[model samples]
Target chain A: MNLKFKHKEVRVFAPASVANVSCGFDVMGFAMGTPGDEIVVRRSDKNTVTIKSITGDEGVLPHDARKNTASVAVQKFLEHVGFESGVEIEVHKQMPLGSGLGSSAASSAGAVLAINRLLGEPFSRKELLPFAAEGERVACGTAHYDNVGPSLLGGFVFIRSTEPLDIFGLPFPESLHGVVVHPHIEIKTEDTRKILRNDIQLGQAVKQWGNVGGLVAGLINKDIDLISRSMEDVVIEPIRSVLIPGYDSVKESALAEGAIGAGIAGSGPSIFALTPGEESARRVCRAMKSRLDDIGLPSDEYISQINTKGAQVIDVKD
Target chain B: MNLKFKHKEVRVFAPASVANVSCGFDVMGFAMGTPGDEIVVRRSDKNTVTIKSITGDEGVLPHDARKNTASVAVQKFLEHVGFESGVEIEVHKQMPLGSGLGSSAASSAGAVLAINRLLGEPFSRKELLPFAAEGERVACGTAHYDNVGPSLLGGFVFIRSTEPLDIFGLPFPESLHGVVVHPHIEIKTEDTRKILRNDIQLGQAVKQWGNVGGLVAGLINKDIDLISRSMEDVVIEPIRSVLIPGYDSVKESALAEGAIGAGIAGSGPSIFALTPGEESARRVCRAMKSRLDDIGLPSDEYISQINTKGAQVIDVKD
Candidate 1:
């Protein structure tokens, strides 16, 4: 509660997220362990915010505080909470851009969580979700919490809405492991957005909604077989899969190798498959990576369990 | 159940049903307490099916066994189980036609259940769902189980689909009461179907699906407050409300009278509100009836609890 003797420099890390999650486009996402972003928030004498540096962005990232997601989140938080001390932020993008792995969400979520911790934890984590979602808006032209919510809150997060920001920490099977494959191609979120149809058929919508209900019920009941069956989304996957390289092949390979379900993560170039345990995760990862390589889109695979603790304090310096 | 010593005459009563339940269109429904249909199944010496008499339909109902829902359902049941010998069916319609209160579903459900009882209970109640649904298809041109599922299985029935008949008997608060108001008018389901849009916008679909998931979760958790909030059906109610007389005024009055939520029951011409107990049910019924009266549409009100027992034998003679 006291901030006078707080650490001068604090760094926090937020995990990469897989959004859409098949049946729930823009409404559901889950956190992965390995690929993540870190943000460093340092105290200064001046009563203003600044972005000192951004690494791993290849010089394309902005320096201004208002324009960038991490700094904008910091700016928004400071302005709302009336924390007037100067804060300098350094964004370290460990995740790849345009990988559909929620890279932008990680940076913004890490920044706000770190800055909040450094400034004595003035706001609750739930209160800070909107700022992270707002940061995602700057990167993707939409304020969606599917990625940012899970990245910040950890585990599997279901975002019912962004307005007033309703989020639920869904109960997923503890043994669930995610096999994620990120290919070396850059498919902009905007370009992926262009592929999706503006309007959906009624039959498809009903079928998809039924699957959504079944999926939630599956998670709540801890029925892995039900989860695998309910994850068969009829609406978005049929259309959006065309944009991803070796999409069908990857899904087929993953399922054949004991993965419960596989689909395009977020907007795609990246793909993810959910398996029951670590063994299936490894098998699915290998299968998916092989499919991508056979299709001339050699990719990197990461075997991860669901990140239960989202963003956490990595280091603090005096 | 032994068929050789079958009952000479049997009469079965099936409770009326409320389909859709706002958020889940064509996928969910529940049975109400009163104003249900009665069907008489009699064993005859002749080797042909016949409809002896029809009541309460004012001769609008077909006399041919093949054309009627009750006889069609009976025929389907007999054909599936290879039951021989002649059977006579007498139709009785307790509820008004096109009341948006599952009148057709009640007829089919009552018929199948009664015949199943007469033939010695060869099929379980779950297996009888398809025959009832098939009978519903003859009545409404769609084999949806929203009405028939609840009318046969009772309680809060959710039909994920009718193909393999994926149904969940959702655990709802036992004290929940339904207040129904049916105006002296008829809106054909076919006519109501013409008013609905064929395609839905992506944003609306996501919000609707999220609410559906929330609804299932709320029912599972027995969180009444959450159910009340999650029952908002933005996708269906907006488009279908136009078919009902004084729809907005009636819904406004119901919610104003402390009803948790109110919407068009299945299609139009009838409105129902869910309340916590009998007292609130009475209050909501009065509020909704007054609204219909103010709009010059005198309506009848029914305050009933959930019909946990779907269809039952009123009288059976050996």
Candidate 2:
């Protein structure tokens, strides 16, 4: 039986995203320029989905389409389009696993793009979101689109609701640069999700809601100072940050260095800071990364503007 | 000694405002046309603040300048401007007392604007928000800028923070009309505040935050459908609506009649609904008013375009 494609093939790129963006935990995210993932898909002769190869994930990810995130995403896409033909997938993880940079989501976003392209482009980029979000249900215990939504749609993505699957892109502030610091430590997403309390105080909820609204207002108005003031996460940060070492010190360091706002990225281990320009972002990255270093934890830092283009077809083959 | 002003005076019109706006409790507010308060500020001879007269409030409001919301606002303005001269204030409450229409905030907002204009505009309109918020502290148990901010700055105002106060006006959607239904029964703001639970479930809080962020996005983008979908109030509405008569039925009726969203106006007897155009707004008003009518409760219904110009000077004395 032939396992490879007859002729149709496609490759797609998907960017890593920063979920929560400090104040909007589980509801907002934005894409980054580098350290993304890529996937290659080919329509095959065999009537079963196959995972050909996965790089940079340390061979830890499952090969079965049902058990893997990107492959599951491909399965959802095929099921959605009613395409019963077999598809082979190749995932290249440009980012490290457990880095709090939406590594799993990037793989899923990339695979959907490749599969969708291979299927004669049956869906628009926006239409590919649910299929990618379905991948999240397999990667994490629960399904969410805060990561995949931004990773697929680009810019600042606001997940208004996941139950009804309402998501949209927001305006990225001009001159805004993201300074992300990934500490050389591993923290499972499930563990972070488990740490949050089932109940929250009303006062704390009010503060968090205020910040979320303020952050959205800040972005749309291009008010950087307002962004700095509103990037506070009163609910999830206090609980989840406890699991990450040097969380408080790193955030304080970034704030002290004139960074607009600083908080833990995604679930944990990685912290990010936002600044208006390249210089301040570099300055903030240095301050935050050095603070982590003080705690005996080495870190990897990346600086880039908000990625306006989300998942893209870098190459397509017929 | 003449209690009234000797020569200089200024009167400002402060529009009635809907605070909380269903989802944004204590953090969001928007102004409405007509049925507002009028405050007249005049230069006095003595170095003391006094309330010259109070109308439409049944003369129940405090006469002492330090205790009265309008006079307290005037005192704060004078202190902020470093002015030693005394001021006399006259408040005409066009809206009913305890009508859930931000009556106290309207009075406070008007006094500050009149006082500022009388002082040759020592501060801008945005700068006077804090002074007006300070007045809310005298009226309500705690200080909040949701009502004062919109009443002073106009349009859709977001109260980011009260400390070192940061507030900005969001773009008001065009062709958006406000449909307000105010029942004759009065519910004190303090009573409503007391009935609220100090704690809220994390799930509920997350829903509320998502809605607030969505609402901000909808208003900025002028997405009316998104606004309708995002106006769900999970925390405050359920709890606070219990205090109002026929709250649930009224909301259901409004939704059935094509109202975008509806909830308790501020803290109770008054409930407001939002719609895209004047026709739907009027239809929603009839539906809500008819519901109240069935409940054996008389209600005053107001239909108007979302007031863009907040407080204005119908007459500016030089």
Candidate 3:
């Protein structure tokens, strides 16, 4: 059988994403611009996937094709498309692993995008989301789309349901900027999930959903003040903040520096603050870093507007 | 102190609202065009508020100024504006009381608007919400704003927080129409409130909030399909539907007749269906009525476009 390939090699860039998003926990996220993963895929003669190389993961990420998120995601895509030829994958980690920045999602998203392009784009970016989520299942226990959805679909994404996989992108203001500060500490997603209560008060749930509606309205209308007011987490933050040192102080610093709102990103030790503009985002990032500095902890800060384009093909070679 | 009156008498029409719009629960509602209360306020020589008469309530509503929602709301408004003159209020109840169509809210909202205009428009309609809420407090045990907010605000209103009185209007499609079916039996708001579980599973809460977010997004974007998908209530509907006979069948009938979505209108007995336009709304209303008819139950049906102009001055006398 003749292999139909648009490009012999393809390189793709997939963005990091911030999930949970305060009151929108387990449902909302947005892609970021700076910290991302780059993956390269080249056609192989043998019908077997291979993880040829991995970079910048501090020697921790798996090298086996079945174990690595990038390779696993690629394999899923290949199987879905019934591709007979195998692909050699190279994983480049641009963001901190387990930093609440969707590190695994970026790798998985990038890998799928790269392989799809090499195979002449069999699937649209959105169709690749499930394959990317499979990577998240391999990395974690749940196949949650909060991280991978945004990382693949771009902009602000809302996951309405996970079972039937209903997700959509939300409109945000052009002036909106995001600041994410990741403290050099790891809080496993599983541990954070364990800390949350199995049940919540009906009143609290009402308040949380109220904020969720308000937040979505605020984003749609581009009402900065309303957005700031609605960015509150009544359920999860209080329970999970205990895992992050100086969480309160860091959030206060971001707000004090004119951030629209601030909250724990994903599962934390990463804190995210939204600002009206890039300058304010930078100021908020500095303030958040200073708070962590006061506690004698190092942190990595990223500033970006919402990534409107998710995964992009950077290079293609015949 | 002299009472400065712009007009000797003022009559206002305040809309009946559907609260707890499916997934929105306690935070969302919208005004209806028909079956609203018409309140007439005439300047009285005496300095104390009085209820002159109430029509269509079958003598069930109170005549005492302190107990009557209309008079109490006007009293609150008069006190807030420091008006010395008393006003005689006439409550014209156009909608069924205790039908979960926010009948009390209509009375309170209409009274406040009428009295405000009689007192030379001392407060904006938005400013009249608290006074109307006080009326709800008088009727029900707790002061909730979901009903009064939209009845005064004239649109789809979202209450972010009740304590600080944070509320905002959400944009929806111009073609949106509402169908409300009030089954003859009354399910008291307090009884419906009692039946709800104090604690709900966290997963259900997440799903509810996700739907809330999706609903808001759908409204803003005018995505009819998303609106239908998001009009699901996983928490309150399951518990409260038992109180209303043939609840599922009635909702199914509405949906089957091309309604976008349908659910219990508040702490129902009243079921509301939303559709793309007036024709579909009428069809859905008929379908819902037929379902109730199937069970040998009588029901009152209302068809309305959203009341964009919430309360209006219908008459004035000098």
What DockQ results do all the predictions give, each relative to the true complex? 0.63, 0.78, 0.90
Clashing pairs in 2: none
- Give model 3's docking category: high
- Ordered by lDDT, highest first, the candidates read 3, 2, 1
Q: Report the C-alpha lDDT of model 3 over A131-241, residue by residue, as the tens digit.
A: 999988899888899999989988999999998888998888988888999999878989999989999999999989988988899888888998989999999999998
Question: Estimated TM-score per prediction?
Answer: 0.94, 0.95, 0.98
lDDT score for residue B163 of model 2: 66
Q: Write the per-residue lDDT of candidate 3 for residues B1-318, one digit (tens) a residue.
A: 245888899988989999988999989999999889999999999999999999999989999999999999989888877888788999999889999889999999889888878877766788889999999999998889999988988889999888777898888999999899999997788899988999999999999999999989998898999998999999999999999999999999999999999999889999999999998998888889998999999999999999998988899999
Candidate whose TM-score is highest = 3
Candidates' lDDT values, in order?
A: 0.84, 0.85, 0.90
lDDT string for model 2 (B1-318, tens) is 112232388888998889988888878889988668988888888898899999888878999888999999889877766678797888888987788888899999999888878776767899888889889999996878888888888888887767667777888677888888999987888888888998888878878889999999898888888889988898888888887889899999999999889888888689999988999998899999999999999988888888898998777554
Residue-by-residue lDDT tens digits, candidate 2, A225-282: 7888899998898888888888999999989888989888888688988888889988
lDDT comparison, 2 vs 3, better candidate: 3
Tell me the lDDT of model 3 at B285.
Answer: 88
In DockQ terms, which candidate is top? 3
